[model samples]
Target: MGSDVDFVAYVCEQAGLGGALSYRKMFGEYALYLDERVVALVCDNMLFVKPTTAGRALLDTVEEAPPYPGAKPHWRMDDVLDDGERLGRLLVATAAALPRPKPKGPKVARPGAPRKR
Candidate 1:
């Protein structure tokens, strides 16, 4: 089943990270980003945070699972959702550990479009 938008919004609101937190819907799921770095995935109403050294260290009970089929296991964060402070901390650490996203290439002109003189 697809994840509900309310669930995704609740998750972001619970993070309490303010403007830095955002989510994008993909297919039937959602990807949560912190400061432009992808920090977690919400699928089937389950939250899967990207595993990182700092993030793992903060977890009291470590759990791992894939957000979707054929994907690598992430740190399943069902236990941490209610704790906004811990969730914020983990997200910051994960975002810090992750490399910045690669720059997107410039758009190419479509064929048959009029060229500039």
Candidate 2:
């Protein structure tokens, strides 16, 4: 009986994925994010990641049920979830693609917009 924290830490440690990989509670489960981009998830001690060259490969090696049901197949990409190398590559790729957190600018009125009296 592994919890979200346990699984998340395990993934980061096991896969040796660098950068900040966080776990957020979503859809009543834990969503895995690499540099703030959702890349995978941990549910019921099962790992389900989005489709990627590495992620797909991970899914390809396993034949277990995916985290989310009503989905096409087991795992997100395929039915298997193995290969730490792929998982690491996937995490690195995802981390590299993460969008930088830009400072929010103040909203300004649109052109020709009426001024509030």
Candidate 3:
């Protein structure tokens, strides 16, 4: 089944990161990004945080699972739905550990364009 919009919103809201928090639809699921770094993924109404030492230390109980088929095991954080503070901290730490996203090159206009009268 496909993930619901409300679920995605709820996850982002709970993350509580002041830095640009955004999500994008991918393969009918959602990828949650904090400051351009992908922190978590919402698939089938479940939250999966990227596994990191800092993130793992913050969790009370660690549960490893894949966000989707053939994906690597991540830190499943289903219980964080109600804890915005914890969720926010987790996301922040996860984002900090992840490498910064590479800058996208500017798009160039096509040559031989029609001239305007």
Task: List lDDT for all candidates, in order.
Answer: 0.92, 0.62, 0.88
Q: Which regions of candidate 1 deviate over 4 angstroms?
A: 109-117
The 10-residue segment of model 2 with minimum total lDDT is: 72-81
Q: Could you give the candidate ranking by lDDT, starting with the highest? A: 1, 3, 2
User: Of 1 and 3, which scores higher on TM-score?
Assistant: 1
Task: Choose 1 or 3, whichever is better by lDDT.
Answer: 1
User: Which residue pairs in candidate 3 collide?
Assistant: none
- Model 2, 38: alpha-carbon shift in Å? 0.4
Better of 1 and 2 by lDDT: 1
Model 1, 1-117: lDDT tens digits are 999999999998888988899999998899999978999999999999999998888888888888999999998889899999999899999999999999999989899999989
lDDT of 2 by residue, 83-102 (tens): 56666776666556555557
Which digits, one per residue and each the tens of the lDDT, describe model 3 over residues 5-107? Answer: 8999988888776547899999999999987899999999999999988898788898899988999998888898799999999999999999998889996
TM-score of 2: 0.55
For model 3, the run of ten residues with the poorest summed lDDT: 107-116
